[model samples]
Target chain A: MKLYELIIIGAGPAGLTAGIYAARKKMDFIIITEDIGGMTKYSWDIENYLGYQFITGPELVEKFREHINEFNVEIREGQKVIEVLKDEENFKISTKTDTYFTKTIIIATGRRPKELNVKGEKEFRNKGITYCATCDAPLFRDKIVGVIGGGNSGLDAVLQLSRIAKKIYLIEIKDHLTGDFFVINKIKKIDKVEIFTNTKVVEIYGDKFVQGIKIIKNNEIIELKVDGLFVEIGSIPNSEIIDFVEKNQYNEIIVDCKNRTSHKGVFAAGDVTNVFAKQIIVACGEGAKAAISSFEYLKYL
Target chain B: MEKKVIVYSTKTCPYCKLAKEFLKNNNIEFIDYDVGEDREKLEEMIKKSGQMGVPTIDIDGEIIVGFDKERLKQVLGI
Candidate 1:
């Protein structure tokens, strides 16, 4: 098996930034990712990332991939890393297709979408229930849709659906909508959007296509009929592959100021780490720190 | 003789683009069908492919789902 000086586990902003820095340092490394952009690709627009006033998430990632394509660092796509074994001196990373060894490892695997866990949620996935609004929004035009949760993602989905779908049901378990105030104000004005605060999606009922959602509020059950259900409850860190690694209460891997973990040759960055904000800019900043730290670590060995 | 390759896909699917790119890069001639908008063709594709996902390639009657690069390489003798 071929060994690398470093192996980055993800290919999002964090992983891409790390690859750019590593390549600049002339380090021999490889980035393994199932998808080049990760969950961030679902974002419709990002005005926060530096150097650009406004950019789409997918477009930004395309530029990031282009930046890396200029480098010597290898980029292996469609590789889902399933396991990581940290030995005394080196680490062995195993994917569904191949195994790789690396002197140092960067755990920028990031997070996965939190499941709704309601009945028929899994059975009706892609049938009508989708997590990615940007990806599946076009399929929902002129249709009736319901969005679960009250966070930024849910609010964003509601806003997106208001323009396309004929009707939208914004169901939130909390008493108030918990997204940005500006977004909430905009979504509240749309006549097609009917807000159902303090409502919980108890069950997802569907067959070949989503039929409706069963929501409970104040001991009363209300079933809202819709063709599509967008679940944006929350996110879960993608640390299942490295369960052996120590993590905090939120399942976020604890890292120092430099993104180093409790393990010697292992580092982590982005949403998976215990960072205050889960923005693209923060992820890129953390990634740069992790790469520089890794470079410094390699010098001692 | 060059084997006939047909791809059943949708406009919105990213996987379909990848499969098409993979085939194009290998200089393979293939027929394209958008199953999303074409309901009749979608049913026909599901009946043949036994799957609902896009980027289903029908290589001379053999159906393959997604972009299985290794399998495609094997069948194409690339």
Candidate 2:
């Protein structure tokens, strides 16, 4: 088997940035990812990603793709890394179809959406429950929908749905919406949007498709008739493939200032790690740092 | 006869792009509908699939929702 100098196991902001850095350093590396953009592609709008005043998620990811295309970086898309094993002095990555050997690995697998786990969620999945508003919001045009989550993700979904859905029920389990103040202000002015804090989804009920959702607010169970339910309840790190790395309470990989995981020759970056901030810009910086750290580690070997 | 593949998608959807790219890369010929603009196709997709989601792929009369790569490979025999 041909051993690579480095293998980046994602193509999000962090993984792509790491690829760019690795290529510039003239390192023998390849990026293996299930998808290119990761969670960034699901973003409705991004205003703080530096250089660009305002851009949509897909648009920003296109630029990332274009930037990486400039480099001779090899990206194996549609292949998800299922396992990572440390083999003596090298690391072995196993995907569904292929296996790869690398001297060092940079994990930037990012995160996946967290499910509400309420009843009928699984049965109604893809029926009326969707996690991607960027992909499915247009399907609910002129229909009624409910968005769960109060963070930036939920707010983003609500913002996207506002322009399409006839009425939106913004349900948040917390006492107040925790998204950016600007978004909250904008949402308040949308007459079709109804904000419900201290609310919890008790169950999702439907027939062939989603018909309504039962939510509890102020000890009262309210059944909301809706055509669709957009789940924006945040996400959990995609850090389960490798078990050797140390993780925090939230299961996010713990990384040092150098983006090094507990396991040597294995580094982590982006939303999968316990970084202070989960921003695109921050992930890109961490990815670069991880790539540099891996290069330095490879020098010692 | 080759399998009939139709992709109901929107331009801004990443998964839609992925689905289309996957088919194109595999040398599979498929028809793509921009349901976001084509109201008639959008309604046709919704009526056929009974759901509203982009990248709803129809492969030889089998409706596969979303970009499930493994499922796609299984259905397409790729």
Candidate 3:
């Protein structure tokens, strides 16, 4: 088996940027990912990413893909990494179909959408419940939909659904919206959106499809009839493939200033790591740093 | 007879793009529908899949929701 100098385990903002840096350094590396854009593709309006004043999630990811494509980088898409094992000096990454050996590894797998875990959620999945508004909003055209969460993701879903759905019920457990001020202000102007703060979805009920949701607000139980439900509460880190690394309570890999994990020759970046900010630009910078750090570590080997 | 494949998707959906690219790369022929613009196709997609999600692929008569590459490979016998 040919051992690679490095293997980047994702193709999101972090993994893509790491690939660009690794290619510039002329490192023998390849990226293994289930998808190209990761969570960035689910975003609606991204005004914070540097260089572009405004860009959608998929648009920004397209630019990233283009940039990485400029280099002769190898990206194995549609391959999900099932396990990562360290054997003596090299790390072995096992996907569903094949296994790869690398001298160093960069984990930038990012995160996945957090589930509501309430009743009837699992039963109604894909029936009337969805996680990606960008992919499923058009199906709820002219119908009533409920959005759970007041964070950026939830607000983004509402913004997209406002143009499609007839009525939107924005439910949040907190007393106020927790997303960016700009998004909150934008959502406030939409009269069709009914904001319910300090509310909890107790149960979801329906027949084959979702018919309504039971929510508790101010010590009172309220039933809402909706055609679709979008869960955008938050996300959990995708850091379970490797169990040797230390993780916080949220399962986010712990990285130092240089994006180095507790285990040597293994680095992590982006939302998967314990980074203060989970911004796209932040992930990109961390990815570059992880690449450089891995390159430096490889010098002694 | 060749298997008929239909993909219901939107232009802005990344998963939809990925599914189309997968089909193209595998030398599979499929008809793409932009449900975001075509309301009739959108309704058709919902009625067929019993759900509202992009990249809903119809292979022959089986409806596979989302970009299940494994399922696609198995159903298509690729």
Candidate 4:
């Protein structure tokens, strides 16, 4: 197998940024990701990322890809990294169908959306309770739907569902809506969205197709009849594939300022690390930091 | 009809993997093609479904896109 100076996992903002910097340095590197865009591809619009006043996450990452393409960084898309092991002097990275040896590895496999553990949630996944409203909103056109959570994604789902669904129940577990101001304002303008703060989804009742959802808010339990339910509470890191690495109680890898892991020659970045914030910009910054640190570690060897 | 299962796919697609897994889990055999690698088949896929995305499934000529596991199970009677 060919050996690389560095190997970067994931292709999200963090991974892509790392690739840009690594490529600029003319380092021998390869990036392995199942999709060129990670979970951020699901995002429709992002006004927070710097440089662009407002742009879609996918569009921004496209620019990152274009920049990295200018260099010789080998990109292996449609491949999921199955294993990462440290050998005597090099790290062994294995995918489902291929293997590679690298002097250093950067783990940037960000987080994935958390699932609603309600009964029938999985059974009615494509049938009703969905995580990506953008991907499945058309399925509930002119139908009643419920959106759980008060985060940015939840707010985005409410706004999108408001356009397609006849009635939308925006349920939140907090006393106040916690999404971006613009999203909340947009959702407010749409009278179709029924805001229910401090709400908890107890169960998802459906058979073959989604029929309704049960929620508890402020010591009061209520059932909202709907055809679809979109769960957007939050995300948990995608660390299952690398669970062998030392991680915190929350499953985030503990990395130093340079993104070095407990194991030598192993580094991690992005949402997989115990970073203060889990934003696209922050992940990208961390990815750059990790790549630089990986370069320094290579010099020591 | 012996449950005609047809998988419209691209040569390089990861979503097609999930769709194939769905068929395999149900023990349903399917005929698939790499439309991305074949220009004629790519046009056929677009014309048949008017979709530009890959991993489109045709169960008894009913069109579906992406993995769409649930819809595949329902249409294929899996």
Tell me how many clashing residue pairs each candidate has.
Answer: 0, 0, 0, 0
Error of 2 at A166 (Å): 2.7
Better of 2 and 4 by DockQ: 2
Poorest stretch of ten by lDDT in candidate 1 chain A: A132-141
lDDT tens readout by residue for model 3, A76-108 = 998999999997888999999999999999999
Q: Which regions of candidate 2 deviate over 4 angstroms? A: A51-55, B1-41, B56-78
Q: How well is candidate 4 docked (DockQ)?
A: 0.05
> Model 1 over residues B44-70: C-alpha lDDT tens digits?
776786545566798988888777888
Return the top candidate by DockQ.
3
Q: Which consecutive 10 residues in model 3 chain A have the weakest lDDT in total?
A: A132-141
Any residue pairs clashing in model 3, and if so which?
A: none
lDDT of 4 by residue, B1-78 (tens): 667777766433445655786688788989887653455665576677754455778777799977766687678775
Residue pairs clashing, model 1:
none
User: Comparing to the true complex, what docking class would candidate 2 get?
Assistant: acceptable
DockQ of each: 0.16, 0.40, 0.41, 0.05
- Write candidate 2's Cα lDDT for B1-78 as tens digits: 689999999876877887898899999999999887788998788889987777889998899988888899999999
lDDT for every model? Answer: 0.84, 0.92, 0.93, 0.80
The TM-scores, one per candidate, come to 0.81, 0.83, 0.83, 0.73
